[model samples]
Target chain A: MTISVLVVDDSPIARKMIRKALPADWDISIQEAGDGDEALAIYRSGGIDVIFLDLTMPRMDGFTLLEKLQQDDLNCFVIVVSADVQPGARERAMKLGAIEFVPKPIDPQALREVLREYGVMV
Target chain B: MSELLLNDDQTAALQEIANIGMGQAGNSLARIWGEFVALSVPRIATVAAARLPELIQRCVGDGRVSAARLLFHGAMRGEALVVISAADRRTLGSLMGFPAPAGDGDPGAQLLHIAETLAGACLGGIARQFEATIGFGAPALIGEDLPARAVVRADTLGVDLALCLEVRFRVEARSLAAHLVMLMPRQEVQGLAVLLDRFLCTL
Candidate 1:
């Protein structure tokens, strides 16, 4: 079984890091977006099961995207992976419907735990 | 110093690192001011003492501006400068608990305190990400509504070309805004590149 993942961030390096962090054993198909607008488009195109999002981006940031998703009742699970590690940030993301808030340069072990907790990986 | 250069990956990594740091800084500012803070994606480049010209242009271009500069040492060594316009300086001054009409208090001291809070949160956030500890020197008010180039203390400027990271923090729905400029000397650039590479490899 394969899970479709979308990694959204303005920094290519961040996207690369997220790609590297995903479990190697999981049958995951990954898509990348540079900002929220692009991620929304990709999600609308279907086949996305999970999203790793960054909050700060050039056009349409993660918070606004969350509002859009909530308004439309988008069903995909979103995990905010950002460098903005502030209590307020976590509160805001969770309030906006993010299932988890992972700090930037996410730890592989912690990421695995989240994936497993969500049953995205065994 | 021969011009220090960063490869594309190194540059991209630095930008992301700066973004994370600045986002946290913005959060700190917003909390204190009781407002939302907007952050610019950090711009990175290797600059010389010439950084002052651009900084002067940015802060003073709008109007009379003030600046406070601080030094940070330990795993990373460099200067952190906070530049704000006169109007924003007044706003930040009031936010820092300086009671009175913003104009009545010492704008210089106010800029220094604001700089400490801003530079501390910003550089502290970056240091944490680098897994390094950094210490700050007392921030000095380098200039206040001063004439061209005076805002930049020419004598205190470092001789080496610097890896300069620039980020802007603007308070939403208010005129309060600041520029946080961090200058990492060329001597530290190689070490920084190693650290960036280490981060890349660990991923």
Candidate 2:
């Protein structure tokens, strides 16, 4: 079965970059969401195996979305994509149940490693 | 209080400096999008934070407005930038070769990404020129009905003054337009002026 993915961010460029960074061989169907509300809607519809979420956004942020998804006990891997690498943001995201925290100005190699760890690709 | 405003010479200097910084940002964006981007002549204006609503309405008018907001924090300065209009976002997206959404999705995300990239490039360029270690938080989408206090707190702390600089741009090939508004604390503004003066003297 092909893995399904959801790319959630408020930036079109970020989503595009993440889309490009994904391995080409993976049989994945990518979907997009702009904010927490939209992401939640997609999650409720099911079939997604992985989520790439942004931290800062309008209407609802990634943190809140993570919280909600965890609260609902939804079964999907969430990897946070953020530029806020101050001090504790990463720890906080991991503690909140995000599988990984990826910094902005994304490095393709890093994304490959994360995807491999999540078993989204070999 | 009137001294907070830029004088003719200072205005001209700022125009030049901002143009240079924005040009650098445009080049970085162009490389990422693979298209040519041009910024309009800078415009200077002074207003209290309370006027932001009217400012947004007037500047954006009826045109669809999409914004990318970046917040900067530091001991020497604090700033907030709002990049406005959807057309500009679409142009940047097209340049990046993002396929149109095949399903229901937030189109705003693409714009936010472009805005974040632009903010990083502009800030990097400005910091390179000033030799300052500026910190940028992240970029987010600004709501049309953004609270005035949110923007006020973004630029000022208690009694500190905020210097607001507005930069507009037009993408000629796409016929799209956008604006970049930077809000820096008063002391940073003064420091920036001094730095600009020094740079000008050398030039």
Candidate 3:
């Protein structure tokens, strides 16, 4: 099964970097969103398997989106990818319902391990 | 002194570097100041030195701006200018646990302290990214209600163009805000360009 992934960040370069991190050969369909609102729209549209999120954004942040997902009881596999590596940020994101936290610029090896461990990739 | 030319990738990468630095800076202030900080997307560009006063004025929003300037030296060297609205200055002492200003409690001193921590953390954050070491000079406080351009006089830095990074931080709990900008003169911008290239290769 091809994993459907959404890369959400305000920086085009940052989204591009995240794209480079994913295995080129992996069977994955990728979509991009500039902020939480766009990502939420795509999420509501369905078929999104994993969300790589960024914390600080223009309209609705990752933490807010996470809260919304929780409030709606939306089943989500959110992995926060942020430059804000503060300890509090990580704890807050997790409390709101993110499955994993990856610091920027994305470490491909760690991300791969996360994908494999979660069975998103065989 | 030439136009600081940068391609699209270089420009985007520079902004990301500034964003990463801003994140670390926000984390430091939030941890020590006991407030959540909301960061604006950083504005990165190369601007002519002539337009600086106008640019600085726009960032602070009013001439009665309180500012602290610090010089940072490293493989990459530049100056950091942090300006807080006089309106927001009233909240600083209490936020950092400093007592009421008694009479005219060295507001200058207080502003310098905040700038040192905020700007130092930001530069330190950027250094960690480049795997470089940076040392900061003492913080200097500009007078209250001074023009923002007073922070840098034309004859002082002597460069016709500069690489600039500007970011705003909002204190979520108190609704206070600070405008922070970092600038490197012509020579250092060339160095920064090379560093941006190395960062992109890794990406």
Which candidate gets the maximum TM-score versus the true structure?
3
Please provide, for model 2 over A43-109, each residue's C-alpha lDDT reduced to its tens digit, 9 standing for 90 to 100: 9999889999877566787778989998989699999876544234567678889998887646779
Query: Model 1, A17: alpha-carbon shift in Å?
Result: 2.7
Which candidate number would show the highest lDDT if scored against the true structure?
3
lDDT on C-alpha atoms for all candidate structures: 0.81, 0.65, 0.84
Candidate 3 CAPRI category: medium
lDDT of 2: 0.65
State which candidate, 1 or 2, has the greater lDDT: 1
Better model by TM-score, 1 or 3? 3
What would the per-residue lDDT of candidate 3 be over residues B12-82, giving only the tens digit for each residue? 88787778888888888887678878778888778888888778888877556788899999877999988
lDDT of 1 by residue, B12-89 (tens): 988987787787788787777777776777888776666656655664464677788999988778889888876677
Compose the digit string of candidate 2's lDDT tens values, residues B1-203: 33455555566555544544565666666566554555444455655555554555565564556566777654225555655554455455556666667641455676667667666666565555556656788677665334333333423344334566665555567766556677665556666677666645643
Q: Top model by DockQ, which number?
A: 3
Evaluated against the true structure, the overall lDDT of model 1 is 0.81
